[model samples]
Target: MKLATYNVNGVNGRLDVLLRWLDEASPDVVCLQELKTPDARFPLKEIEKAGYGAVWQGQKSWNGVAILGRGRKPILTRRSLPGDPDDLHSRYIEAAVEGMVIGCLYLPNGNPSPGPKFDYKLEWFERLARHAAELLALDVPVVLAGDYNVIPTALDVYKPERWAEDALFRTEVRDAYKQIVDQGWTDAIRRLNPDARIYTFWDYVRNAYGRDAGLRLDHLLLSPSVAGRLRSAGVDRHVRGWQHTSDHAPVWVELSDD
Candidate 1:
């Protein structure tokens, strides 16, 4: 089975691009982030027509997340991250598909470091870390996939020095990610292509896509059991060049059948 994660930027605004890609790539399951629309405006008909049954949490003009299963319905598990009942951003959605638990998340961007937004980012990361640990303890196969909005190392971004002050590349954020991975989850893409500079997102401004200037923000982390099933992992970089496409491309991993 192939499981993929993509930050669609805006599901409503780019439905056409999303449909077209779905037809071409045909991932068995997909975790989508940044729907940028409300639940009522999610275009369920369009997505269902493309052969995916989905469970989504959406917000207006900003964060949202969804999980889609091809030829099947994703059994809803949780719609919001734990330990943040007061937090209202639509950034997380979880489900069960094909015997595996899938958690889709859109971590806060936390732009402009040394500020409240950055503080919130760190807080959110900590919450995620705790939840991730709980998930790991379950000992059931899980795929944590989505736009983490973090660059774990200099190798993840094209210009390390330029992003030093950026929240995504800051030491604190990277360390949080490391803490989660250290809980025994495997970073699929990095495990598959250890020495390559693989990336999933490009800035909309500055012709970043054209220049192949991008960041490896989207990730698929497999629990130890699921990691053992990993067959291949890759980014559909060419998809980012499509007209009206998202700034982020699709990243997927193929796993052996159970």
Candidate 2:
């Protein structure tokens, strides 16, 4: 099966580009983030018409997550991140598609570092770690896929020095991500293309795309059971050049059948 993750920025604004990519890539499952639309306005019909069914957690004009699959509709497993009952950001949504448990996440951007947002990011990471541990204990095939909003290492970012002060590239964020990977989950992209400077997101400002200045923020972390099936992984970089496209390109991994 082929699984992909993409931060579409805004579903409504980038609908056309999204549909085009879906048709061209035809991944078996896709985890989406940054829908930026309310549940009622999700354009479900449009997506269904493209030969996929989705389960989404959405809010107005901000963070949201969804998972789409070609055949059966995914069974929604969890909508909230478990620890914080009051946290209402539509950042996480987990579902069962086929035999795999997939988590689509839009981790907090936490900009303007050394502030409350940054603290929340760390706190959120802790919650995710707990949830991930629970899933790992189950030993079920699970794939955590989406815009983690983190740069795992210097190799994952272009001009690491320039992003050292940024929340996405800060040491704390990277360490948090490292902690998760240390839990025995496999980073699919890195596993396949370790030395390649593959990037999934580029800032809109400063002509980042034109200069190929980008970051590997979007990812797919597979549990050991699922990691054994890993076949190929890559970035759909051309999609980033589309008209009115999101700053993020799609990242995907192929796995053998169970």
Candidate 3:
């Protein structure tokens, strides 16, 4: 099975790019982040016409998440992260598809660190860790894929020193990411291409893409059962160069049936 994750940035604005990728890639399952549209405007018709069924949790002008299953409807499982009741951002969504659980998320950006936003980012990470632990305990085949918004290691960024103080690369955030992975989840891409300088995102400014300056912000974490089936993983880097495309490219993993 082929599973993929993409942060479309704006579902409506980039609908064409998304559909084109869908047709080209044909992944069996897809997790999407940053829809930046309200639920009412999710464009189900267009997606369905593209030969996929989807369930999405959307927010206007901001964070959102969705999961798409090719030739099947993703069984809705959860809509929001469980830890905070008042936290109503459409940043997390889960579904059951193709005999596995898929969790899609768009973690906070937390820019201009050392402030309230950064604090919230950390708190959210903690919540995600707790929930992820619970998921691990289930011992089922699962894939947690999304735009994590955290540059996990120095190797993940183009210039480690320049982003050292940034929220995404800050010590605290990387530690939080480590905490979750330490729970026995395998980072699929890193597991398959261990020493490669892989990147899934590049800023529009400074000709970042042309300069090959990028960051591996999007990730797919597989549970032990699912990890055993991981056959290959990669990023569709060319998608990032498409006209009016998102800053993030699609990241994916291929799994064996057994």
Candidate 4:
């Protein structure tokens, strides 16, 4: 089975790019983020026509998330992160598909460090940590995949010092990701491609893509049972070169049937 995650940037604006990729990649399960569209305008019919079933959590003009299953509908589990009741951003969604629990998330991009947005980003990380612990306790097969918005290590970023003050690459954010991984989840891409400089996102400015300046912000963390099934993993880097494409390329993991 193949599972992939992508931050579409804008589902409506890049519907063509998405459709084209879906046909080419044909992943069994796909988790999407940054839809930038509201729930009522999710373009369900278009996605269905591409031979997939989807469950999405959307908001207007900004963050959104979804999971699509090939020839099957994901069984919805959770729509938002569990802690903050008032938090309304469409960032996290969980579902059951292909015998595994998938948590798709678009973690906050806390820019302009040392501010309220940064604080919220940390708070959100804390909430995710708490919930992630609970999910670990379940002991069922689970794959946590998406744009975590956290550059986990120096190897994951092109210039570690350049982003030292950036929220996505800050010490605290990296520590948060470490805490989650310490809970016994395997970082699939790094595990499979340990010596390579793997990256999934490149900014749309400064000719980053041309220069191969990129960051591994998106990830797939697998629980022990699911980790055992991990067979291959990689970034769809070519997709980033396409016209009208998102800054993020899809990251995927192939798993063997247990």
Q: Which TM-score value belongs to model 2?
A: 0.99
Write down the RMSD of all candidates, one decimal each.
0.6, 0.7, 0.6, 0.7
Reference-based lDDT, residue 55, model 3: 96
lDDT of each: 0.95, 0.95, 0.95, 0.95
Clash pairs for candidate 3? none
Candidate 4, residues 81-196: lDDT per residue as tens digits?
A: 99999999999999999778999999999998999999999999999989888999998999999999999999999999999999999999999999999999999999998889
| Global lDDT of model 1 | 0.95
Worst 10 residues of 2 by lDDT: 71-80
The candidate 1 region of ten consecutive residues with least summed lDDT is 206-215
TM-score of each: 0.99, 0.99, 0.99, 0.99
Tell me how candidate 3 scores on lDDT: 0.95
RMSD of model 1 against the true structure = 0.6
Off by over 4 Å in 4: none
Backbone clashes (count) for model 3: 0
Residue-by-residue lDDT tens digits, candidate 3, 1-258 = 999999999999999999999999999999999999999999999999999999999999999999999999999999999989999999999999978999999999888899998999999999999989999999888889999999998889999999989999999999999999999999998998888899999999999999999999999999999999999999999999999999999999999996
